[model samples]
Structures are given as structure tokens and as C-alpha cells.
Target: MTTTTPAALRAAAERFGDGEAVADGSVRLSWHDLLTAAETVARALIAEGLAPEDRVALCAPNTHHWVAAVLGAQYAGCVAVPVNTRFTEPEMAEILTRSRARALFVVGTFLGVDRLARLQGFLDGVTVIRIPGEGDRPSPDVIEWDALGAVAERVPVEVARARADAVTPDQVSDILFTSGTTGRSKGAMTAHRQALGVAAAWVECGEVTSADRYLIVNPFFHSFGYKAGILAALLSGATMVPQAVFDLDRTLELVERERITVLPGPPTIYQTMLDRPGKRPSTLRLAVTGAAPVPVVLVERMRSELSFQTVLTAYGLTEAVVVTMCRPGDAPETVSRTSGRAVAGFEVRIAGDTREILVRGPNVMLGYLDDPEATAQAVDGDGWLHTGDVGVLDADGYLTITDRLKDMYVCGGFNVYPAEVEQVLARLPGVSECAVVGVPHERLGEVGRAHIILAPGTSLSTEDVLAHCAERLANYKIPRSVEFRTELPRNATGKILKRMLRDG
Candidate 1:
């Protein structure tokens, strides 16, 4: 019943052994190999003087190495801090400095940019370990990536497993920083119990198994990828195929070639796949979509056109990793419309009249790292973490997220939720997608600005868009300005970058 991540992984390696556990570009590792390599990396870090509970930052894209680094840190009794490779130099520095990471495992390049070059100034005095990629030359200052295995050869596997088993559930496993959409990202200190609990719940709710070849399109830096994704795959013995960068064509080929069984990501991922309908493998069984509004039509398409056995939509945040997930047997309509009921271990409730979603569970984080004031503000005295998401709990305990409490804008002194407005735009004629943001108004404090992406060969005038909203929403809720664009701005995870819109 102990919920240590390393111990659980050791058990998985024992059971699955020679079965394929992970696959990168051309490299595939059996469970036994993967576990041994991870422990090797841990031993290497220990030799470099990383102490228990010390943080080691892993700054790289989705790959086999990223998984190994995280698991290796767990095996060494250190906390893994995953850096968002897409972040700017300052953003990455903030996480590294805040986590107080003494060692860094990073890639030289990501998405055609030299990430190692940018971090050179910030990473002074830190023990650097380079994950060698193509075109990367050997550096004397940085430790070679391949040396980890040789280092592990010196340390006994029994000693590594003993260190792993000695780790307590209360030990901090990882410190994940939230995407700073609203403000500065805070490090959420998550214990081994919380991480394993959430991963196990995701495997159960997402219906992932050893037979499932899980294609992880989501980045390893995000919770959707790290916990619910790669970790969930390991817990269930699913083979993890991580995609460093999501490309429509490449992803389709991988899914078909590998017969990916479990695939989960934001709605935009499915939208892109749906737009470019091609030869996809029939092996896709379960699809979980969340991190944004889940249109009922998208869910229907995934089930009917995409040939998935089950399509689920769930809602959670970096603080808890998972809260609600649709059961495997739930109605398709329910799965599409609601974010399902709370997971077995968590309790969810709408707080007072504001209807802000509040969660209380073992999955909730211990607190914000080194920030007691922010932690107190986020979680109430009653042990409820106040999730700033605005939602409505249906009669059946299902939650439908309407908008972020911060995203809601008052138009002409009337309340307007952008998700509600965006939903109306989605159903409008000739509209393919739309995002709504609040803009400062002369008369009102803030007014909704609608950015529409029209369907191919379709056109909608500003007058027509305003007229369409006139029928669905109140006069105050109607968007005053309509801008048509070829595409809306989105983050790596497919969530709209509303802050960019506000600044632009």
C-alpha cells in the first residue's frame, strides 16, 4: 500500500521485464532495461554529490531521456524539477533558481533553437549534464549523457532498489510549476503519495493497460504529460511513445505505425487530426480530451469517425494533477458535456455563490514551495484548495467548466463568461474556431473581444458575428469588436494564449 513512485516502478520492471516500456525516435527499451538505466542515472547523480531531497532540473523536450531523468531522480531520493523547454530564458531561470537545483540535465537544441546556449549565463556553477542530440559536440565542462550507465555499473542494483524502497510516501517526488498564464508560476510541492495516487487514478480512469501503446503528444514539462501521461503509462505497463513536438502528419504516422491505444491531450489536438482526416490506425481504443472546453461534436467525431472505443473528457490543474474523469461506461453525451465526477479519492464542491471550483483530496499538493503566503491564499483553513476555475455542477455531480474566475469580464456592468461566448461562436455559421478575451472599454470596465477563425472558403463580417451573438447572449454579453484571423494563438498544450491577445 506504500505509494512510493520508485518502488512501484521497480515492481513494474520485475513483472514486465522484457516487454517494451518506452520508445524514442529509433531507440526502444524493455521495462527491465528502462528501470536499470533510470537507476543508473540516479547513481551517476549521486556520485556527483546530489543529496536526498535535493532538486535536479531536467530541461528537455519529450524523449526517453526525460522520463529516465525523472525516474532516476526518484530512485536517488531527489526531487525532479522539469523545466518548460518552450519558456524564455528568464522563465526557465525562475524555475531553476526557485527550486534551487544543484544539477541540470538539458538538451542543446529544441525546436531549432539553441537552449543550452541561452542557459549558459544562468547555469553558472551548476553541475551540467548534456543530453547529446544530433550536431551536439562533446563538452569537457559538461558530463556526457552516456556516462550514466557506466556509473550505474559501479553501483549495485540492489543498493539502488534499497534506496528506492527506503523512500517514504511523504517524501517530495517532484516540484511542478504552473504555467504562468495569470501571473508568476508557483512551484507546487507534490509528494510521492500524491504523484503515485494521481497517476494510478489516471490509469484506471483513462483505461490504460500494458496492451496499450500510449502515444504521448503532450510535452513532458506539463502535468498532462508527466503525471497523467508518461507516469500513467508506466503504472499500467503501457508502452510510452513520446512526441517531442506535435506535428499533424508525424503524429498520424506514429499512431498508425505503432498502433497507439491510449491517446490524451487538449481539444485542439483532436481538432487538427479531425481537420486532416487521413489513414489512422484502428488500434486507438481510448481517447481522453481535456485542458480546454470539450465540444460535444468533437467527442462524437472521435468516437464515430476516429473509431475510438471510448472518448473521455476530464478537468484538473497543476495543483492536484487530476480531480474529475469520466468513467469508462459513462454516456457519450455526458462525457462530452461534463468534466465527469470527482476521481475516487478527491472531493469537489462549488464554493458559495461565486461557484469557483474547490477541491479537497490526497492528490492536492502539500503547498507552494517556499511561499507560505501564496499557499495560504490558495488553500483555505478547511484544507480545500480553491481552484480559481468557474464551473457549474450538474444534477449528477458532473462539472462543466465555464471560465476561469480571472478570465470573466464585465461588459457594460454585466457578467460574461468567455467560454459561454466562445461556445456560441463555435456553433455560428462559417466559424471554425474562436477565442474571447477581455479588453479595456471607455464606458465599461472591460468588454469582450472576439477573435474568430473562419472555416475554409467561408467569410463572416463583423456585423454578422455581432448579429449572431445578439440572439444567443444578452446585449451586454455581445462582443463589440470582431477580428477574423487564419488561426488563434495557442500554447504548446493547445490552450489559447489569451494573455497574448490581451497584450496584442
Candidate 2:
């Protein structure tokens, strides 16, 4: 039985051997080749002086390098910290500093931005390894990805293999940072057992198999992409075909060319495909999606038009991924309306008068990294992780997410916390008071709307506010609309009533 991620990788290599493991564009890696590459990366990191249990940050989009780098980090008994590629330089710098990452595996260039060059100011005492991207530029200080083999020569391969074998199930495997109501991102630590356990649950629930060719369109920074996309494929021996960016034309071309079997994405992806004027035939058979609400029509059309045999919606947060998922044969209404029942040894219950969703399971995160007070509040004494989303459970035990308790919203399948946006908005020169709220958006499920009150005699245009946000925040977190007001509505206790703002 596989208990850890590295073990799962090793088992896949041993069992599948020459079977294709990753197919990224022209680069194809068999299971055995993947293992050899990951081992080389492990040896390189060991030689680079990354101690066991130290943190290593990866800031890149979905690619073959991401898969190997993360697995290599785990093989060396180090924790992998996946950084969001959409974040600004300052945001990325903050995460690197907060995680205390000893080394960074970053892309040289992506989307016309020189990631490594932009981060040069903040990478003190940290080893920088550059991954290949679109624009070709080399820095003397940064180590090239291909040079890992040379670095590995300094450390014996046997030592790296022993380190991979020595990895225990209880060791912290990854630190996934998620934003909270406090306007700060907290690193949610997950053990090797927890990570693999959730991936196994997702694989079983989705009915993933070795013959499956999974198209991972989601970004690797998110849990759904890494745990459900990569780790689940590792456990099930599915071929991973990662798409770094989600272009409708490219997605359709890949679907037809690669004979992709499992395609999991947000509801918008299916809707867009269905609306395409000239849709291509696809081999898509299974889809497990949830971030925004899945409409019954969308679910039906996915089966009818997109040729998906199974369409499942699931509910999960950074703390406990794959908490609830719809089964293969569930009714369309059940699949569309609810997030299915609890899986992976998790027990779900609606707690308190607020109807907050509470989950308890072996897969619950160990804790927020290095923040005991925040961890105590998140996970109670009874071991229930207080998922700050309001939900309802029907007689059949299916959970329907109705509202959010954290004032957080999902924008284009990414979590956008209002507090985080408000914090950024407050930094604007003319902004005296501001409250951000999630408003309905046709395409992006929900988007932020900033209600601002400027200082006396100070004026600012919407363009200025948006421009300021564009520089500091990710694209999804930037408010879609800005409303200037004289004052914000508040209760007697002086707390701004965000519900009123959202309602208006």
C-alpha cells in the first residue's frame, strides 16, 4: 500500500515502467524516466544544501518541470511550497519570505514577464533555479534547470534514494497558503499521509484508472490542480497532459488530438465549449469540477454535448481537499445542486446558528504553519476544521453551499477574500475608508466591488483605484467595479455591514 507521495511515484514507476507518465507538448516522459529525473532533482537539492524538512518554493504554471520539481522536493524529505504564478512580484516575495524557503524553482519568463529578473531584489541567501519558459534570457546567478544533473554529481544518488525511502507518512509534505478573513494568507500544512489520502479519495470517487489521460488545465498552485490533478494521476497511473494556460481553441485541439479522457475544470469551461460555433469531437469521459455553482443545464449539456460520461461536482478548501464529491451515477440534480457527500473518512456537519460547514477527517490539514493562535481558531478542540462557508445538508446527506461566512468569493475559479482586497484598496492615496464585497458576475461567478469613501477634499477616479490595484493584486482579486460613497453603512457596534453593500 502506498502511504506517501514519493512512495506512490516510485510505485507508479515500478508498476507502469515504460508507460507514458507526462505528455507536455513534444516532451514525453515515461514513468521510469520520470523517477530518474526526480531522483536527479532530489540529489541536486541535497547538494545545494537544502536540509530535510526545509521549504522549497515553486513559482511556475502547469508544466512537466513543476511535476518533477515538486516530486523531487518530496523525495528529498523537504516540503514543497507551490506559489501562485499570477501574483505580483511583491506578493511572491512576501510568500517566499513568509515560508522561509531555502530555494526557489522559478520560470525564467512567462506571459512576457521576466519572473527571475523581477525577483532579483528579494532573493537573498536563497538558491534560484530557473525553469524554461517562452522568452530565453539567462542570469549568471541563477542555476539552469538542465544543470541539475551536474549539481547531483556532488551528492551520491544512493543518498538521495535513501532519503526518499526514509520519508515518513507523518512528515509535512506541502504548505499551501490560502487567504483568510484576516486579510493575510496562511500556510496550510498537510502531511504526506493526508495528501495521499485525499488524492486516493479523489481518484476513487472520480473512477480514475491507468488508461485515463487526464488533461490538467487548472493552475498547479491550487490544491485541485496539484493534489487532484498531479497526485491523483500518480496514484491511478493516469497520463498527465498539462495545459499551462486555458485557451479555448488550444483546449479543443488538445482534447481531440490527445484523446483526453478525464477533463476537470470550472463550469465556464464546459459552457464555453458548448457555445463554440464549430465544436470538435472529443474523447472526454469524466469531469470532476467545483469552484462555482454547477447548473443542471450545464451538467446535462456536459454529458450530451461534451460527451462526458460522468460529471461530478465537489466541495473542498485548502485545509481539507476532496472533502465531499459526487459519485459517478448520481442524478443530474444531485450533481448540480449539491457538492455530494463526505468522502475520504470525513464527517461533515452543519454547525452553529450561522450554518457554517465543519469537517473532521484524517485529511484535515495538520495546522497553519507557525501560527498556533490562527490554527487554534481554525481547528477546534474537537478536531473539526471550521470551514468558513455556510452550507445546508439535505435528508440524503448531500451538501449544498449556500453562502460564505468569510466574505470571500470565487472569481474565475480562484478564491478572492474581500478583506485582502479591502486591505489593498485602503493603500490608495485618496481612500479613507473602504469595504469590498462580492457581486454577481455573469462569467466569473462572482467578482469584487469596492465601496470607497475618499478623504475630505481628496478625489480619485475609478481608473486610478483600479490602476493601483493592478500593480499590487492578482488579476482575479482586483475589484471589477468601484463605487464612491460619502459613508459606509454600519451597525451600532461600528462594524460595516458588508451585506448591505453586497445587496445594493
| lDDT for 195 (candidate 1) | 89
lDDT of 2 at 185: 90
- Tell me each candidate's TM-score: 0.81, 0.99
Q: Model 2, range 49-132, lDDT digits (tens) per residue?
A: 998999999999999999999999999999999999999998999899999999999997899988888898889989888999
Regions more than 4 Å wrong, model 2: none
Question: Each model's C-alpha lDDT?
Answer: 0.82, 0.92
Q: Which candidate is the best by TM-score?
A: 2
Highest lDDT: give the candidate number. 2
